[model samples]
Each structure stands twice: as C-alpha cells, then as structure tokens.
Target: MLPWIFIGLALFFGVFWFSGNAANILIIYVIGLTGMGVFLVLTSLTISKQSNLLKKAFETEKNYPPLLVKAILLFAGIGMLFGSIRYWQDVPFYQDQNFSVISGKPSSIDEYNSKGTVTELYVEIKGHTFVLDADMPQFPKYKKYEELLDKHFTILYLPNSNWIIDYKVE
Candidate 1:
C-alpha cells in the first residue's frame, strides 16, 4: 500500500515538473520519480512483515512502512531543493542575447586558428531568431553552424558588425 502511495506521489510531482517552466526542474523530477518508484516496488515486495498486516495494508486499506516514507521524503526533498537552486541561477529560455562573430566574412574554406579556448557562444538575440554570424572566427568544432562550416566557405559581413559566410554544408 505504501509503495503505491509513493508511486502516486511521484507521478503527481512528475507531472507538475513536466509542466513547469524550468527545464532543470523537469529533469530532476523525472530522475526522482524513477528512483522512488524503483525503491517503493522493491520495498513492497521484500519487506518481511506479518502476512496479516500485509494483507490488511494491501487487500483492505493502503498502508506503507514508515521508514520507507522517511527515506523517500528525504531523498526527494534534497533533489527538489538542489534543482530549484540551479533553476534560479540558470538563464531562462526567453532572453535577449547575442553571439559574437569572430570571422569577418564567410568563406568556402575556413580556418580558425586562435589563442582563446572558447566555451561560451555568441548569438544575435533579436526576438526568437538566432542570426548566426556566417563568418565567426574560432568557432567551436562541435556547435558551429552546419551550412557555413565546410572546409571552404564564403564570408559576408553585415554592416551592423555581424558577419555572414558560406561554407560547406557538412
């Protein structure tokens, strides 16, 4: 009975997290629910209790082990607290942001040999569309735009300090 209750609670929390605005919260909720569900199922099947009590808990009224509830609560509370903290610190999906253009123009064949080890991305944040600089210098190998990222590409510069480029589609 207790296992079922925990499972229901996990499902309820899971739904709320999925509907919320925070992506991190959704991730944590999924992990927490899955972990708790597994724990409850295992406990329901394994706890050595009097057959009569077990029957009463399951056949008549739903009841669960207090220790199990305590453990689940503790784990869930910690996860929720941590996730909330992270959500507060991260940038929301809706934000006005921009990306820096490193390459002056787009090139058919592009080469970025730079001194800075880049981790952050520069984007032109106008409303929702991210106008990637066609010619971004020192672009990251993994995240560069696909269209303007061939061995050879053309570089175009927008008068507004943004660069456009034509590179290999691959």
Candidate 2:
C-alpha cells in the first residue's frame, strides 16, 4: 500500500510537471515514453498473488478494484487518447505556435510599442502586419478567444495594438 501511494504520487507529479508549455512534439514523445514505462511497471508488479487476490475478492463481491485503480486507469486512457490524437493530427501547443492571426500568415515579430503601461506588438504573418494589443478582443479577456487559449500562454500574440483599456488606480 505504501509503495502504491508513492507510485501514484510520482505519476501525478510527472504529469503535472509536463502540463504547461507548447512543445507538442517533445511533450508527445516524453509522454509516450513515460506511459510505456508506467505500463511496464504496472504489468511487472501485477503478480500471480495479486491476480488471485483480485479474483477471490471479485468472487466474494468484495471491494478489490479500489477507486484509486479505476481513477488511474481512466486518466491513463484519456491521456493516451489525447496524446495520440495530438501527435497524429500535429496539434500545436502554445509555445510551438507560429500562426499569425491578423494576416493569416506564418511570420515573426517585427516591432513592439509601450505607452504608459500599455503594450502593443506587431508581427508580420504571411506578408501582412497585424497589430498586437494587450487589450484586444483576442486577449485573455476576450470571450471570442477563450477556446483559443490553452493552458500555457506566454507565446500568445495580440493584435490591434492601440486598444488599451485603462482603469483608475484609486
């Protein structure tokens, strides 16, 4: 039981550590490897004694398949499915993202501006210069952009560079 608790904690931390960021390729790769490792570990640990115990418990209608096991299995299945789909579909994480919302082009930042505490950035996507405003509708506060925002957000670019909303400090 203690070993199982330790293993569960390790797994939780492992997944949490990899939760953020946009390295889709690297994330997929690491998770794939880690998942295989976990599966192998679990399989090796499931000895004949454990199987017999489970069978007997099941036959007696005892509580052998604990909630922990069910939860772990559920999470593992979901994670594997999500990772495989992301890899196969080439889903872009927030950091690896290079898409320009303004011109619908692939490009990098060209210039940026800051006025009084407000900031704006411009990136030439495809071949057009789209404004990046910290207060744009596509910003985190923008309802239209909620689904677009993933867990990690450092690489996000906002357009309409001059639309800064100001509030009184008092």
Candidate 3:
C-alpha cells in the first residue's frame, strides 16, 4: 500500500508535468513542497513515540524504514522542482506583451485523424494557422472544433509554437 501510494503520486505528477497550466504547476509545486516539509517535521517528532502505530496504520506486513520514506519524498520533491523550473522558463513567452493577436472567424478548421481518432486540431485565422493538441494548455478552451467554425474569435498566441495563450469568442 505504501509503495502503491508513492507510485500513484509519481504518475500524477508525471501527467501534470506535461499538461498542467503554468500557474497551476507553480501552485502545486509550492503546495507539494510545503506538505512534504510539514510531513517530515511531524514524522520526525512522532516516529519514535508512534513507530508501532505507524506500522499498524499502513496495514502492510513489511515495515518501511524512515530512510526509505525520506528518500522517496526527496525524489518527488526534486521532480516537482525540475518541472516547476521548466514551466517557469516558458512563462515570459506566454505573457500578454509577447503574444500576437488575431481577430477574425476561422477560415478553416482541420482535424487530423489517426486510427479513427482526432489527434490534432488546426485552425486558420487570417493567414496564420494554430495547432492544438490534447496535451497543450489551450486545447480545452477550443476543444469543440465545429463550434469554432465561422465564429469570430480573438486569439492571442505565441508565434514560435503557434499555441493559443488566450482567446475570446466575439
């Protein structure tokens, strides 16, 4: 059960690292770090007094040494820190001043199909094209591709990735 909890935490962070918004990532990073710190401090204070209680609470036959728990926490903390740093590096590019705006109804909306499933959505507005994928931050906002057709939309996007940073239906 202890190992399963750690595995679930790892997978949660892995998915969040790829698809989470920059602001959300930062918030989670802070919260996760703070929670880990508090847990370590509390555990250190009570481990000797409640070692048996802790073992029984976990309901596992095997005991997890304090060192192993600390190691796992350290590893998770490092992974969150790395992901936060990487997301922060791209924050400046998503700022309002860095984004290019296009205001008009989309001329064409294309969905790329792979194995009978839509893998990518491409929207052409004015003369520029923007690509959206499930993993992208902006994909959820424009997910209903058919609704976007012939509807006037003001989109702010990064020029390099052509990923929408913001959009307004007008």
Candidate 4:
C-alpha cells in the first residue's frame, strides 16, 4: 500500500514536470515535501509495531534487527529531504512573475524527431533559444510549425529550463 502511494505521488509529480508551467514547480515542491513528511511518519509508526507487518508481508526468512530498519529509513528520509530542499531553492525561478519574454522572428526553428514523430521543438529568437516540449500546453501542433515560420512571435518563458510558458505569433 505504501509503495502504491509512493508510485501515485511520483506520477502526480511527473505530470507537473511535463506540464511546462513554471508556476507548477513550486506547487510540486510543496506537495513533495508534505508527502515525504507523511511517508516518514507512517514508516516510523510501522517500524515501531512489534509484529513488523512489512517484514512479515515480505516473507523474509532473515529476521532483521529493528535498528537496521530505522537506519535504512533514516537514510531514505535524508535523501528525500535533500531533494525537497533542492526543489525549494528552485521555486523562485519557476514562479510566473519571474518569467522572461522574447519577441522577434525566429532565427531558426528545429524539431527533434524520434520513431517518426516529433518529440521536441526548439525555436531560436534574438539569440535566445526556447524549447517547446510536446506535453507543454503552448506547444504548437506539428502542422502549425510551417505556419510559425516567417512570423514574428512574442514568447513568455522560464529562463532556467528554457520552457515556453505562452507565445503569441504576429
């Protein structure tokens, strides 16, 4: 059950990563920290129980000492805490108010294809390169790439990840 919960949390976070919305990063960071705290509390409770349900469920022949379990949990918690702190540090850059804007005709437009499908799009304008991920809401359709050519565009983007948040073609 805990594994499933972790998997669900991972999937939830993954969706936000693929969304290409800078503002969502701070939300994910907060949720991730909360989830890690919950995980640590639950793990501590489970470890304290005499029967050790997790060990029984795994059906391990070797009876591991409680100290070992606690140590392992501690290490895991520390790793997760480190990750959360790192995410927190990046939150400011992902905020919507920090978005940078670029406006001009694209000096070059490139598409990276994989297995006969366009997977990533790169547009360069005024010496700055911006990426339009396929999962991004602002990602133009494949057919629209041609239309984008020869047009001036104004793009709002996250500088850290070079992700396009919003774009307007003129």
RMSD of each: 13.9, 13.0, 9.2, 6.3
lDDT of 1 by residue, 1-170 (tens): 55556557656655655544233233344445454445444544544444445555555433355445445655665555554543333323112223222332233322333465433333322221123322345443654444433333222322232323222212
Clashes of 3: 0
Q: After superposition, how far is residue 73 of candidate 3 from its true place, in Å?
A: 30
Better of 3 and 4 by lDDT: 4
Every model's TM-score: 0.28, 0.29, 0.38, 0.47
User: After superposition, which runs of candidate 1 have C-alpha atoms over 4 Å from their true positions?
Assistant: 1-13, 20-64, 91-170
- Decoy 1 TM-score against native: 0.28
Best by lDDT: 4
Q: Which segments of candidate 2 are over 4 A away from where they belong?
A: 1-13, 16-75, 78-82, 88-170
lDDT of 2 by residue, 15-106 (tens): 63355122323444445535644553453344333454546656644445543354555466456545444333332432454332322333
- In terms of lDDT, the poorest run of 10 residues in model 4 is 16-25
What TM-score does prediction 4 earn? 0.47
* lDDT (Cα) of model 1: 0.40
Ranking of candidates on TM-score, top first: 4, 3, 2, 1
Q: Per-model C-alpha lDDT, please? A: 0.40, 0.41, 0.57, 0.63
The better-scoring model by TM-score among 1 and 4 is 4
Q: What lDDT tens digits, residue by residue, belong to model 4 across residues 74-98?
A: 5665566666664555457666367
